[model samples]
Target: MSGADQHIHIEWRGGTCRVKWWSGEYLDNGRKRYESKGGFTDEEVAFNHGRDKLYEIRHGTHVKNRDGATPMSDWLDDWLAAMDHGHLTERGYRSTVENHIRPYFKKQNASVADIDVLAYRAFKKHINAKMKKASSAANIMMVLGMVLDDAVPRLIKTSPVERTRRRGKFVKKPKERKKDMTPQAVEQLACNARTVFGQAGYVFIWTMAMTGMRPAELFGLTREYCYPNWPLSDPRPDDEETERYEEDVERYGRGDNLMPAIRVERQVQYADSTLQFFPPKYESCRSLVVPDFLAELLKDLLASHDHKWVFPALKGGSLGAVNFDYKYWRDVADGADERSGPRTRGARPAIPPVPSFKGRRLYLLRHGHKAWLDEDGHSKFATESRMGHEVPGVEGVYSSVTVPMERAIMKTLQERWDRLRGGSSGSDA
Candidate 1:
């Protein structure tokens, strides 16, 4: 074919062919672009490859050429440095790179292009061999995907994670099943916490159960954000509570039964023995309504403490989960069992002496809160907001939290509080 009619030109070397083609368009600056691909056994195959490359560039599907020869470790370091640190905690970033990414990639000296789906499969197998959690494995895979995706055309042509179909259905691994706690168990645990760790633990456990706040968010709470009688932000900051309450009534059309609310905007995390405060997970900044009883308790608790932290450590600093769990939660959880009684002198407590669920975690209280909200028929939007989770899909976009919904949540929490106190039912506010 003539050069004008032929989109691709091919030339044969000893055993291979080289193909060249115009990208078929002028760039925005009126510059012509061409492409070349080689190493095909036949001229036709080389031509087809060149033609496909031209089409990709023309269609804006081409990955721009960048440095692809960097080692996986070096690439990861650069990528991590360039990442939006706000999106994840420093610990999370370090954990993924150290515990997951490097361990899998460092063993191989191969470039990014040499890593394929089989490499990923082997990495997953290695993680599984170590008995890692399914969720942890999944997260590692996700991080790898992110790296490979960003490495396109520069480091690798396409992602090597296989997305194959079986019988017209997409293949997917089953997620790990997290245990959920019941509201009754939550109440019992909270009471046990009170007895074991004093009033601080009691209020902390109850707040988690009632508000569905993440442990980090709960720890991040400050008195200024806890509006026991009004919204976190009064439209008129200079105005009195009565004036702001009246404004809320007019704006939100709320009635007399308004409960307390907490603003969730920050979280505290410990990385490398350093305590740092950051934005809430997924940046899910929102307000949560609390029961009147909880509000009163929180007010009293805040009044008693002179520190900025709502739940300060015993020695007056940030409370770390590791210390909290070992010192207080383990003992309280053990004491919840009827089988666990007074310890004998000079004897170690019976290992697993409690017949009851001895391994109750603080997070289970958050799960219990969500369950209670579901049981009380709170709107999905309100529940997700309270739980610090973004509602998925169109419903999330359309639905919003309303005063009535908040009122209903407060009413249910109040009812649960009464029931916990051995009352038959709760009276309407």
Candidate 2:
């Protein structure tokens, strides 16, 4: 071989044959680029490999040397920096990348080009083995896939991750659904909370179970958003809110049919030791109808506090994320053991556990509320709307919550409370 045919070269190394192929490209300094690989035992095999490299280079399928050398950790940092996410979302992404992605790739010393199908599968196995929940492992894998896909055609030819559809009878098991709490169980929890953290705790548990509001939403609730007198004290409507106000007034004008409600506008998020208010998840800003009893309960609770938050922390101010779970909720749900203090002056009573709520999360109240709404045979549109979830398709656009729908919800919820308290269904307890 000579002249242009000499662009592909096969030569003997110490103990093996090596191949070098011209890439048919030029550098910024006007020099020809060459790609090479070695360690082939057979001369013919090395020659064939050189020819294949030449073909790939000419077809523009070759990965650039600089891109292939970029480290996985550095690439992930760049991708995360370019993302436009809310404070809370960005914090979560950063946590996942730092805690899982960075460490694994750093240990393997992986580069952008190192994540092929086998490497991706191995990483998935590592994540599954380390993570306690299948859902958490899936989320980590999704983030890795996103990072790899973003490097396409530049750092990588294609992403190694592909979503596979599970088939046949022996498919991957679904996550276990959270258990729903019965009305009696919910009341027991509320009662226990009252004993442990006072009246505020009692009201907090009831509000979550009845309203189906997210924990963040409750943490962010303020006097302006909650209304025991509802439409009577509702703020002046803006141009966009005019039609809603008119409809509300028409439907709830009579004193006998007056309904109380609360507005869901924002939620509290804790990050970097600071509390920030952000729009509700998916921006599902809505008005939620409340039962008369709950309305009165909220009124009394608000009257007792001058703090900005409706459900202030036991020590006052917004509830801290860690403190709420460790100091307050654990004692309330799991029960506290009798203990003696250092000076024997701080001795406290042992609070008995709520059997039904033991080992459960506070978020389960929201789930149980959905189950209750379903049990009561409420319309999908109303129930979903109340839960701050968007209804999809034409049904969402066409169907809306009418006065009768809200009234029925209010009546049933009140009845449920009354029944649980051993009072007549329609009695004012």
Candidate 3:
């Protein structure tokens, strides 16, 4: 071997060895090699030691024939695409790729292999930066582990991610965000929405704060589903007008719906052209819910309009964050939607500021609901149910739904939201 980069030549001389240095990682025999930290005692020892080192450095560890070698970038792409027909949820597959996985790895080469602790640390720093949040960065690690694990029998001899996932000194979730949204702050937002967005928009914001439902739930809500005149189990609506429409809803969605029994159940996401409902996070399936007032408000939001879908969704109520699609509504934090209104002579209460706009993710609303429910003395289990947390058990088995106080809970919630929205004192409401 000659020249000067990081290369070594190993000559077998019985027990003694000869080694020569050159550039690059390949050996004289067309195989890959590595360098040793210390020189060998004999010429033969030097050749054998250097050869082993070269293999270790290139393929990582003392392994032979590093087959299926590809860059991390290529592997991730294959992993994400592979999720298409797999059991993973659309939200899990798509978003795990987008928000956490892809952003950090989009540029990595597909042919590279053998990552060490040092490389991982540096890579983490770079990825942590691109990630929008610390939890998001953590999620990236998780998704990467899953993707690599799926490749266990395929490309990888063993997952580099297994070590990466358990690496030293984990970064804690940032405490600065203060994921709490107070009642007063909620009211302020509502006031701002009413002043800027008028009735429709303000109501939309209020519904999210009160319900704990994702934005899509509000948007995809249809008039027919919540206000159906059928019995709770009966799918059909009433034949006659019945005693009253509002009373029937109040008894169900507003009444029994708040029973403190909840589950994440299912999720709706847009795919191809239409909306599809699937198991929620962890493939959880069931009805996630909150106090009855939310049930009532949701029901009311549906009842007041003739639209079939909950929010202003097109193409049969596409799922996920609907606001993310509408640039006009999206400009709420930026006040970009500011235009001369008939009532006011100025732009609408436009985007407040960059910091303010950044504060309004779907999780923010969920956090706010958490503070509200906790203040109201709701149990942690109930709250978890509202969030669609899955109960642990043996998988590849039957699944069930369970919620104890589903109706009476609604009674309390309805009372609370009326006061919150109507500007009345709701100590118990």
lDDT values for all models: 0.69, 0.81, 0.51
Position 305, candidate 1: lDDT: 74
Report how far off residue 45 is in candidate 1 (Å): 9.6
The collision pairs in model 1 are: none
Root-mean-square deviation of each candidate, in angstroms? 6.7, 4.9, 10.2
Candidate with the greatest TM-score versus the true structure = 2
Between candidates 1 and 3, the TM-score winner = 1
What TM-score does prediction 2 earn? 0.80
Candidate 2 per-residue C-alpha lDDT over 161-262 given as tens digits, one digit per residue, 9 for 90 to 100: 878777778866576556557777777677778766667888889899889999888888877778654455556546888887776665544366677778
Stretch of 10 with least lDDT, candidate 1:
344-353
**lDDT tens readout by residue for model 3, 236-313:** 344563543443334444343323222233456666655665545454333434455444445555566555544543
Error of 3 at 108 (Å): 8.5
Q: Candidate 1's residue-wise lDDT over 229-264, tens digit each?
A: 235343433444476456454533334654567767
| TM-score (C-alpha) between model 3 and the true structure | 0.55
Say which prediction, candidate 2 or candidate 3, comes out ahead on lDDT.
2
lDDT of 2 at 269: 89
TM-score per prediction, in order, is 0.71, 0.80, 0.55
